[model samples]
Structure formats: structure tokens, C-alpha cells
Target: MSNGNEAGDRLRVGSAPDSWGVWFPEDDQQTPWQRFLDEVSDAGYRWIELGPYGYLPTDPHRLRDELARRELTLSAGTCFTAFHRGDVWEQTWAHVRQVADLTSALGARHVVVIPEMWRDPASGEQLEDRSLGDGSWRALGTGIDRLAKALHEEYGVHLQFHPHADSHVDTQQHVERFLEMTDPELVTLCLDTGHISYCGGDNLELIRKYPDRIGYLHLKQVDPRVLAEVQEQDLPFGPAVRRGVMCEPPQGTPALEPIIEATRGLDADLFAIVEQDLYPCAPDVPLPIAKRTREFLNRCGAGAR
Candidate 1:
């Protein structure tokens, strides 16, 4: 194992807006956009991934000014698209292009894609064990490859496929199968520690098994008790997240030390973006955790130095 106290020379730390509890404008009086950016800066984060589009200013100049004020650079932007079906991608491609243009203008190099579902999260749909037909699987791979190449060649953004908990590639076997179908050179894994763990995959093992395939990361930690509840009660993705399943680094299963250790010797520019999916919660709840998480990464010897 790579030393947890000295996690190699290249690994750098960053964060996402989900860590700050501002997923959407859920509350009447939500936290200000500047507040999240300020806290990210105050917490010593040098990079941040754009959460949902329009969560931050969609206008490139305004967004650039906002980030420049905080000394934060755009790490990447998340694009949750249903790339499995061709017609869906036609509608979603516009959103992807907008985000790609924005991220590229901001000098962010990654375009993170999550395969999406149409069902309601509140419906408690269990998708982890599902499998697609052979032709559907091939179409999925082809779609990802095409999107990856287009995003890379046209937008100057590398495409990273995030195997999320509620997505088609939820389980370890599914993630393995997805990678097997796609071009390794075209599609890279945007590993999410919490989602992988929540879906019953070993994040550490996956990182070790495919070091070369990992191009980006969501440094999320999953609560073991919360995951147990999710499994036992058939909880939906939103409810599981709202249950504080993905929390600060020190308070979770698959302990972050080992996970962080597993990330050594990958690409130098890889962004281990800290992402705790806080939903419908107070901004106060995440502020202290953000500070502690950054400090914790530094102490663990995994953060930007």
C-alpha cells in the first residue's frame, strides 16, 4: 500500500458544490452562490467541479469573475446524460454542448458524464442489479465513445464516465462490463468513492485494478450505517444522499486512507474532487465539514501541497 501519510507526489485536492448543501434552490432562503465559493476558498481548496449546470453562473465571464475572486479554478463540470439511447442523447447533447463550451472557456479540462435514469428517486427504484440486452450494451459503449471523442476533439475536454449508484453501471460487475465495452483510450473512469461503495463495490480495489483508466475522481465517503439502511430499506438515491450517506472523509466505510493510498502514481493533473451530496440541508452544516475535510486530506498527505 502507498503510505497514507505521504500519498505520492502528484495527487491534488478539489471539491464540488454538493459538498456545500446547495444542490438546487430547495429552500426559500438558500445559501448564496458566493458563500459556497468563499467557503471553498477559505477551506483551502484551489479547484472546484461545477455541480448542476446553472447552479453557478452559466455565463462564462460572470462565472470566471466569481471563481477568480475566490482563487479557485474550474476542475470540471458534471453532465448527467442518458447516453444509452440515441434519441435521448439528441436532446441532451445541447446541454452537454453548453457545458462543454462553458468548461472549455473556463479552462476546465474534464467533462464528467453520468448515465441517467428517468424514474423518480423517491420511487425507491433499485437499479444496481439490472442488466441491459447485448445490443443495448453495445450501443451504450458506442455512445460513450462518440461522446468522449467529440468532447475531447471539439471541446478540448477529456470525457470521464462516472459509474453512479442509480445509473445503469451501478454494481462492480456492471462497472467492469461498461469498461470492457468502451474504448479505454476514449472513455475514462471518473471514480466516485461513495457511490461505488454504496453500490457494494470496493473503491480501493477498483482504483488498484484500473489505475490507468481513472482520469478523475469524486472523493466522497459513504456512511456504513446509512448504506446498510439503504440496502435494508430499499431507499432511493436522493433519500440515501439526504440521509448523510456521503459525508466527510473520516466518517465512512472503505476508510479514505486506503482509498487515497490507492490513487498514487496516476496522472499528475487528476482532480480528486471532494463531493458530499448534501441535499435540503443548512449551509452551516457543510461549512465546518468542508474545512475539516480539506484539513483531513492535508493530514492524510493526499491534498494539493
Candidate 2:
């Protein structure tokens, strides 16, 4: 259950190998994809996650070739805007299916789902209304059930639900309700540390409660004071993201000890991807964060599976 020293080489902590994975809107210097790949490769990471930016290779052959050229492997890819509106469910499914096919072809096993833009009926807006009654949870569960079935039966891909800020499923109660509603075999959870902690949940407890169901992970840290500010202002989730409230793992204030211990007994294959939404400022900013996270993981000494 632990990825000890022997397995450390396989489950080693590393950066995502591309700024594209972090997706900074301001950092649009128009650097070539090859240049980005070279920088990431030089940073001591062998895996990379694909972003939906212009730099991401859409064509399967081109994507594979680019990754091979850089001697890096595709770790996973993000798929946002799925299951937003009831009418677009079919369309969303089709688009995600294409992504799954691409992931399989590119040799990536996980597909990260961020269901933003989903309307909250009470607010009649894109932002989620946490006060929505129990009915809302039921509806969400049914929708995720359908999507989970499709992802497994149709595309042979695993569905990893990300409980993001401003999204309907952001809080601990929502996550608990979601797990209660969906089938664990088909629908898996992606523990996003920053978002969960920001929304006031003990993420480590959630991970422990559903060890087998966690298929992927986003390792991030947040300063508790900044998080409190976002909650106090009732700020929209998008702005919080823009303000750099979410950051690289092992920084800011969250204590990762519980998370480290919770992951000790998990038998599932989990990818602890270091994702910091900082872009356009400096490329080297993430290096120290990565090194510190690796040291933390090493100190945990649970990497001996």
C-alpha cells in the first residue's frame, strides 16, 4: 500500500513538465511548444499533463511525436465544460469520448473532469449556490452516474471528478453526497488539495474514507489566510483562481501530514501531480516548490509499497 523506496522511482514526485498544464492567461509570450518541452525536460520531470491551450497537440501522431522528442510521457489531460447544461449532455459526452480516445492513444490512463459552467437553478447563473436543497445533490448524482457509465462502457476511460471552487461539488458535504450517490466502481474521485481545503474540508479524511475510489490527485497548497479572505468576500471561484490563491504543493499553510498518512494505505494507482496555476511570471518559480514537495514525500517514508 505504500510506495516505499523500491517503488519511489516509479511514483516519484515531479512537476507536470509544462507550463501549459498550469494554464496562465497572462504568460502569453508565444513560446514554441518545443521550447516549453525542453524547459520542462531540463527540470528533472519525465511526465507531463496536457492543457487545452493552443500549445497542446490535438493530432494524436503529433502529440506522441512531440512527447517522444522530449523523452517525456503523457501523464494525464484536463477535460472541462462537461455536463454543464442538461441539453448539452450528449454533446459533452461526445467531446469527452474524443478526449478519452486521445488519452488512450497517447498512453495516458486518467482523464480529469472539471465541471465548471454548470448552472445553479436557484441563482440562474454559472456559479454554484451552496444553499441548494437536497434535490440538487440527487440531480448531480444522476448526471455523474450517467457520465460514469459512459466513460467506462463506451471509452474504457476512468472518470475522475474534481470538486472545484465555485462548482456545485466544491464542499465537503457535496463531496460526501456525491460519493453517496455514485457507484464507486465506475466513478472515481480526484482529490484536489487546494480546492478542498479552500472550501473548508478535511481532504485527508475524504481520501481515507474512499481509498479505492481515488484514481488521480492534484497536489496543491494554499495559504489559509488568503483562503479565509476568499470565503469572507463570497468571491466567485474564477477570481480566486486568478488572484493566485491556489499555488504549488508544499507551500503556503496547509499541513500535508494527514494527506501523507491517508495515502499510505491506498491500493489504487494515484498520480500526485504538482499543479500551480502560476504562469507568465517566471518559469523557474515552480522548481523550489517541486523540490520541497519531493522532500516532504521522502520524509513521509510511506513510499515503500
- The 0-to-1 C-alpha lDDT of every candidate, in the order given, reads 0.80, 0.65
Q: Candidate 2 residues 41-121, lDDT tens each?
A: 665566777655345677889989987987778777667653434455777777777778778788887777876644441
- For model 1, the superposed segments whose C-alpha errors exceed 4 Å read 1-8, 25-30, 122-130
| lDDT of each residue in 75-176, candidate 1, tens digit only | 898888765655566777788998899999999989989887534454556544355777777778888888898898898889999988777789999999
TM-score of each: 0.92, 0.82
Q: Pairs clashing in candidate 1?
A: none
RMSD of candidates 1 onward, in order: 2.5, 4.3
Q: Which candidate has the highest TM-score of all?
A: 1
lDDT of 1 at 47: 90
Q: Indicate the worst ten consecutive residues by lDDT in candidate 2.
A: 17-26
> How many clashes in each candidate?
0, 8
